[model samples]
Target: MASSLLIMQARLASSRLAQKALLPIYAGKPSLLYAMQGVYGVADAHVLACDVASFSSFEPIAQEAGFAIMAGDADDVLARFAHVAKEYKVDYVIRATADNLIVGQELVRLALDGAIDSDADYFCFEATAHGSGVEVIRRTVLLDAYANASSPFEREHVTPYIYGHPQRYKVIKPVVESRFFAPDLRSTLDTPEDYTRLVEFFTHRAFPSQTIIEEYIAWMRSNLYQMSL
Candidate 1:
């Protein structure tokens, strides 16, 4: 069987929070390192760089930091993703954003298996705002969308065309035990506020073992009222 996972889409660009992925988390390592290492247990992982001319100096940093990085358009993310998919030649792709460092490995393996085994073109965690975990997609399905999608929005954001066009392709979502809002627990390194929150929490804890999900769930339980609100 072909490799299940390949690139973890990441970059040092974000309008709200510049360089969010490379921000230091714990153990004096960059947050991308945390994200890279977190998924390494479940499958082979690489970092997909938003290849921008003159503005993407951090590609070397990601490389020096030990993540195999690839380059493609910064704005046309579908093309970027398709480039990596072709480069790696993976059977399936697990679309995990750099921000989603809290993502679990067992969940990734299970969801990937479902996407590959079933006739599903898209196997997602959810179809709404709470859909913040892992996303699994097969190669044939991705190539189909990558080839046919034409709208600016579709090309800009990868897989939305496929997810939105379920009539054209089968989509499956694996079941997981979840009912609470969970409030993201300040996961998925986003804005400056998010970094402040994450840094404050993670700085006190250790690395690898003291992960985003574990830290968030604990803090969420402790600050339930704040989290609930």
Candidate 2:
């Protein structure tokens, strides 16, 4: 069995919602804590990847969650991921972002299993809620993209290069289950509006353990209904 590492990338510099990941969502917990907890135990190892400047901000939460911290390039996320994968010596990498508070663990497991079973360079769900998904990529595939990818967009968004060149990399996208398919739903914390809505959801509407996709969809539906009123 190949060893896999889950790397959740976080940073404190965002213009739309500055330091949104570190903002408290529930009682007193930062949103990163929730995101970290969401995908806690699915991989062989876990890492919190951030830029050198944001390491201090992220270290405490990462330590609390027992995730190894790696500081790397700020803009070139492909290089950051490659560095972490090489450092950990993992065969496969499960990619995540800190803004996605409800990136479902079950969905992550499914994607990881699909990547391992199909031996594909890349694997993700064909359709999923905006923030309730992850990407699984072979370490060699990531390294290849890091080495040969030249565009800023490819370098900044890791795995885009792999999916963009389907002929060069085997990309597997399994269809999501009907119940979990909600591509229109937005759950990422990116803007002030998103932050306010998430604060409300986490404070008043979430289950004790709120990472499950089914529960998230229910909560979001109820929240949206309330918002429209």
Candidate 3:
């Protein structure tokens, strides 16, 4: 079995919602803790990758969730991932973002399994809900991006350089079940509106870390329907 690592990229700095990671989600737990919990056990190792400024603030949360912390460049997130990938010598990496609060272990496993079976350089689910998904990529492919990715967007987003150049890299997109294919639904926390929506929907609910992907989708769709009323 190829060694796999789940890297959750996070930072305290945000243009839209400041310190959103530290904001309470459910049961007074911050979003980062739940995000880390969501991907637990699916990978051989779990790590929280962030910048220097975020390391101190996130350390306690990461520790509480049993995730190792790695700090690097603030803007070059790809470099941070490369450093972690090389240090751990993992064969495959599951890329996750802290903003995606509803990411689940099932989806991570699916992406990892698909990547291994197809030998995909980059793998992701097609038309899946935004925040519930993660990207799986080969270690060599990620290193390639770290070494050659010149554009700031590519470095910041990570894996974009690989997926952007299909000719040079193999990209895989497996279609999800009809229920999981929710392109219009938005679950990511990038703004004040996003945070308010998340808090309103999840604060009174079950442990979001334990909530399955299906439930998240259902809630979002129902909320959207109610909003349309």
Candidate 4:
């Protein structure tokens, strides 16, 4: 079976922060560029699809970055996702958000690897609605999600209908061994403070290839000489 991933993303159209993706972190690069590079570091067979009303700005950026861009309905995200997944005929699907500047590659790969071992219908790293890291789905599971869910929440958001109604399918959450922590390390891009923290991290090292906690801890410990305080 062909294991593939599709990154569901769009430009900064959110009410919280306008044009967050295009916001510059450091080294004259946008947050979305770092995100794309981070994702590219982990999996190879993946594409980014952004729901822009017109192919005016983001299209060029995605094209230049070597990603396949598609203009589709912004509201009905599940329908868009289902259409793309079916067209690709992917056995496994990886769901990534553009806001996660501190997205974990090793964690994602680890979770995906574990999901394949179990009989779970859905694989996710975090369980809660706030910290939902990422999700991986078997084609069968995704098809079920699309087929069964048809509500306002599902239509606006992508996977909540399936995830919210857990009794319908078996969901998997993978584990990793680690120690040490901090009070808060901004992971996703939403407000200016989050962007500032990311800028602080990026100042140390431009577009790190490591996960959030690892990179933050490394920056704190000064283990990585390439990054400067």
lDDT of each: 0.66, 0.85, 0.86, 0.64
What is candidate 1's TM-score against the reference?
Answer: 0.83
Instruction: Output the worst ten-in-a-row residue range by lDDT, candidate 2.
Output: 220-229
What would you estimate as the lDDT of candidate 3?
0.86
Structural similarity to truth (TM-score) of each candidate = 0.83, 0.93, 0.94, 0.82
lDDT of 3 by residue, 156-175 (tens): 99988999999999999879
Q: 68-138, model 1: which lDDT tens digit per residue?
A: 67777777778877877776666787787778766656556667777767856788754212324777778
What's the lDDT for residue 179 in model 2? 82
Q: Which tens-of-lDDT digit does each residue in 97-190 have in candidate 2? A: 9999867678888888899999999999976777778999999899999999999999889988899999999998888888887777877889
Model 2 residue runs over 4 Å out of place are 204-211, 224-229
RMSD of 2: 2.5
**Order of the predicted models by lDDT, top scorer first:** 3, 2, 1, 4
How many angstroms is residue 219 displaced in model 3 relative to the true structure, after the best TM-score fit?
1.6
Q: Which stretches of candidate 4 lie over 4 Å from their true place?
A: 127-132, 174-176, 179-185, 217-229
Clashes of 2: 0
Q: Which stretches of candidate 1 lie over 4 Å from their true place?
A: 53-56, 64-66, 127-132, 179-186, 210-215, 225-229
